[model samples]
Target chain A: MLFSIHADGPVPIYEQIVAQVIYGVAAGAVKVGSFIPSVRELAEQLLVHPNTVARAYQDLERLGVVTPRRGRGMEVTSQAPTACRSKRRDLVRRRIRDALREAAASALTPDEIRNLVDEELTAVNGKRR
Target chain B: MDPIIETHDLCKRFGGKRAVDGMSLAVPKGAIFALLGDNGAGKTTTIRMLTGQLPADRGSAKILGQDCWAAAEKLRLKVGYVPERPRYYDWMTIAEIGWFAAGFHAAEFYTRYQQWLDKFKLDANARLDAISKGEYAKVGLALALAIDPEVLILDEPTSGLDLLVRQEFLGSMVGMAAEGRTILISSHQIGEVERVASHVAFIASGKLLLTATMDELRQRIIRLKLRYEAEPPDAAVFGSVLQTNGSGKHWQAVLQDPRLEALETLKRTDGIHDMEVSTLHLEEIYCALLARKV
Candidate 1:
């Protein structure tokens, strides 16, 4: 599975994993019943702790995005796409709320904040494309 | 809820020198807290005090709500300590050592011993005297985990391991933390600590300089590299700039800003060609923080 993380972001590494997996499911990169790498493998790939990856997997499982199968590793669930998308939207909303708070604190105009968000969105989409 | 580990004005002295001076910290429960410092910076002394192996010259420490020194016997049973250089009986095999260490716990050792032996990939038949240093460290870690303690205190657990083994060891520690075990690890390996620790306390010259979450500390330190069109920028606003070199036209220095308010100070300066605001790794920040004290 393709996994990408933003090292410079404010989010913790585990949360980043959670967000990315949610994004992956929503984008169909990880389909229903698709097997994800073991915690050790993912942590090695990300140069993080296996426990960090495990935390993400556990969180995903709690949200019904993935199911843990003993020694078989984690697998995406049939309800993953919708649940993941919902979770992603909630996360994005929280981020926006935080951004808005920062903008207000800095006394930035709505246009300036909107333009900043637009610029970030454009950059993200441009990279994806 | 009370902190799982706490010290109030804790001090440790050796002869005339004080290793830890007036140190105080409270680590939240179920968090991976790290102590970052240079050698002789009191990291080891702090760990010893927390584990109740050494008495504090002043103040006190509490581990799991029990006095670290006064109630050491009961407290020690609940705590698992992996010293920097863990020693084992050379005459014993890995299995024998496991069995010996397991004697302290009230539970059956076979299941947990087998689990840890598999987790650490240690051969039960291998003798402690014959294993490599890294292997020995793994055995020590396995012994620590097999006891099923409430708190883990590790002092440079992966100090001498190769990169691969170090990664594996850290992976195992992280797994332990996932099970809601509180861990306090002291190590000079900032990158590895950054991977697993939720909080960090940096010490220097026997003093606790800063204690904050990993995310909070990252946001506090900013690395700025500037190329000016003229002479070097004035140093008054940036607190103290260290290592200002590159002749008169260009200069670079690591600056300290506890609140990261220096960016505004930089924006006010003129004759600047280019500047980049970047984050400093934990190692760089540790070095800078200690260097400033000197």
Candidate 2:
């Protein structure tokens, strides 16, 4: 769905697909049993190798978050929400680690960094309303 | 799964100059392998050897289990080669050439050959000289597929093509790979290759830098920018240091692999204050990698 990828960035294209799909499921943007884009479809859309998309789909299937049908293509499994919730934590942790690293690099004290995080959280929550 | 195409210490020379020197690579079956190198990097030389056009001075090459040089005539029917700049027969119409090549293939393959013509939307009656470069590429592709080749070698198929033509060409390549045909494409277009290639090999100065799945290369290469309170001493904790720039407190180095422990050690070292890590694109990594040889 509404996914953006940086081709020049360090993250591999297939891994990007894996991360975005998990986020899509966790955020309820992708419904259970809904059909995801096939390997050819996504490859044409993303201008990536079809095998890359195939690898991403295979990873999702292996993790029990997606399933393959004989003729209907791949679909988000009913377990997607539950599986994605746990996967989302690790993804979030990696982001936070990078953000914290950046903050420390900026010479900001830990208390000030914590205050900045709180302020950002308040701003995000205010927009959620 | 054995490699459908492979070369062992392949060597070639033109006069006193070495064109391809001790070059070796393997293309596993069903892979879309991108062979990338700068101009004069001997990519064409390597491809010529694999396609049985040029014999190696010292080494050997094989295609689909047959020795390329020893069985050149037999292998030509099996390995389809599309040159970067094809010299077409100006007198023949696109359909005429297709029919000419069709004689070599089975009757059933002609059906698929016709299908490919429709897929490319090529006017069969159009004379070869009247078509655009893109259309000429389609004609070449049509002829290649008409032969029912098991492996396709395309040299710079998308070079100088417009966006739409490149899209169509790439689309056809993906479709071909899906059908289990091994593809070895040589091109300077890193972005396009990154999009459609399952595996990639880098060659420079007739020497191969590396060959790996696209994901593996991305995972191993990285860049680190450091801002220390004082000048930091150089260290080689990772594999190879491709580049190091900046001076005094602000220094940036591109390392092959910046693992956690190596980074932590950099942080733990004296005078280190702040650091940032970034991943490199394939193009940028190749420049850095090739620069070492010069």
Error of 1 at B186 (Å): 1.4
Q: What TM-score would you give candidate 2 relative to the actual structure?
A: 0.88
Interface RMSD of 1: 4.0
Kindly list the per-residue Cα lDDT of model 2 for residues B228-250, writing each as its tens digit. Answer: 77566474765578888886568
- Clash pairs, candidate 2, are A49-B195
List, residue by residue over B1-294, the lDDT tens digit for candidate 1. Answer: 889999999998999998999999998877789998878989999988898889899988999888898998897777888999988899999999888877777676556877988977889999989998889998887777777878999998889899889877877777666667888999877777887777899998689988987667765665666788867766546655533446656666666553246656675678776766666777877877777677
Question: Residue by residue across A1-129, what tens digits does model 1's lDDT show?
Answer: 777765445466778898888898987888899888888577656656455687788898898999988789898999999998887789889988998999989999999999998999999999999
At residue B14, what lDDT does model 2 achieve?
92
Q: In candidate 2, how many clashes are counted?
A: 1
Candidate 2 regions off by >4 Å? Answer: A27-29, A85-129, B257-261
Q: Name the lDDT of candidate 2.
A: 0.85
| DockQ scores of the candidates | 0.18, 0.48
lDDT of 2 at A75: 84
> Cα RMSD to native, each candidate?
8.0, 3.5
Output the worst ten-in-a-row residue range by lDDT, candidate 2 chain A: A2-11
